[model samples]
Target: MLKFFYEEIDFKVPQSLKTSKWLKNISLSEGYKLGDLNYIFCSDDYLLEINKQYLEHDYYTDIITFDNSEEEGKLEGDIYVSIDRVKDNAINIGVSFDIELRRVLVHGLLHLIGFEDSDDDLKQQMRAKEDECLLLY
Candidate 1:
């Protein structure tokens, strides 16, 4: 199940982005199963604040994942995403909005699956895993 928690207002995500088996597939690709997954959609300003306050960085990022998996074993976390950034990225990448959105969504899920991208070397690996998971869609 995917429940959205808005950091700003009660905005609704498009019905197209609702919970799916694809998300479950992402969880399984990492040798895990999702009991519940939560996503948080916010504006660039809102997410920037979270990035600064929680991560101690002061720049805009595409997405941030909060791992809440505990003894309960649910793939719990808050996927903070900026729609404004997604729009620009879709335009720059020359992909449709839905495709770009799915990329970002999967990116955050990949992070929960032990995929790290803290440096240049690992970024490539992360991208590979992302692309690998992209095959499902």
Candidate 2:
């Protein structure tokens, strides 16, 4: 199941049903089943605190994914997204807000599906996979 929440932000995610279907498809395409996945949209400060407390990082990022998969081929986790960052990223990347937001959403799910972007090659592969998944949107 995919759930959406807002923290320290009043923004509403558009097209909830459609986005859910796309996310479920993302899981299935990767040979995994969707589990308890949560997407939390929050302000940059809120996410920064989460980063400092949970990840021990001081920088603000667009999204922070927490892996909670319990078994093989099961995708479960909490994806914390900074709305402020997303807006800035959208302008910087020359994409619309919805497009950047959806990309970040899929990016988090890809991490739960055992995809990592820790290196250049992996980042490229991850981006490619994200593009493929975004097409489903």
Candidate 3:
């Protein structure tokens, strides 16, 4: 199951049903089954607080994913997205808000799928995968 929630934000995800189906398809294509995924949309400040509390990080990030699956090859987690960051990133990168939002959304799923960006090589691989996933969206 995929669920969406908002915190300190009054925005609704556009085309939510289509987005959910696309995400499910992405998981199936990656050889995993969708378990229970929750997406929480919030302001940068809200997400920053989460980061400081949970991760002990002082910087702002677009998304923070918490993997909750006990079984291998099954996707389950909470993905927190900062709408403020997404909007700013869209403008900074010359992309539409929807496009950037989808990128962030899939980026979290990729993390749950075992993709990492802690290094340059891994970041490149993750970016390529994200681009490929965007094509499927």
Candidate 4:
């Protein structure tokens, strides 16, 4: 089950059904099954509060993912996205808001699939994977 929620934001994911299918395909390609996935879109302030409360990080981030899968090879989690950051990133990266939003969305999913970006090499790999997945979108 893939669901989307909003917090301090009125935006809805465009072409949500298509987005859901594309995400499911990404999971399948990574040898995982889609389970319960939730996307929570919010303002920068709202996400900042969550970051401080849960992660103890005082900085702003584009997304935060919590992996909650109990079964092996199943992807389940809550992905919180900051629309404010996404919009700013889109401008800074010279990409459309839609494209950057999708990138952030899949970045969270990739984390749930065990991809990490804590190091330079891992960050490169993650970016490569993100680009490849973007092409499929």
Assess every candidate by TM-score.
0.85, 0.97, 0.98, 0.98
In model 1, the clashing pairs are none
> Cα lDDT of all candidates, in order?
0.79, 0.93, 0.97, 0.97
Against the true structure, candidate 1 has what lDDT?
A: 0.79
Candidates arranged by lDDT, highest first: 3, 4, 2, 1
- For 1-137, candidate 2 gives per-residue lDDT tens digits of 89999999989899999999999987898799988999999999999999999999999999999999888888889999999999999999999999999999999998888889999999999999988888889
RMSD of 2: 0.7
Per-residue lDDT tens digits of candidate 4, residues 12-111?
9999999999999999999999899999999999999999999999999999999999999999999999999999999999999999999999999999
Query: Which pairs clash in model 3?
Result: none
Query: Which wins on TM-score, candidate 1 or candidate 3?
Result: 3
**How displaced is residue 131 in candidate 3, in Å?**
0.5
Query: Which tens-of-lDDT digit does each residue in 1-137 have in candidate 1?
Result: 66667766455655545446677876876677775678788888898999999999999887999988784445777789888888889999898877777888889888877779989989999888777777787
* Model 1 misplaced stretches (Cα beyond 4 Å): 7-19, 72-74
lDDT of 2: 0.93
Give lDDT for model 3. Answer: 0.97
Over 1-137, each residue of candidate 3 has an lDDT whose tens digit, in order, gives 99999999999999999999999999999999999999999999999999999999999999999999999999999999999999999999999999999999999999999999999999999999999999998
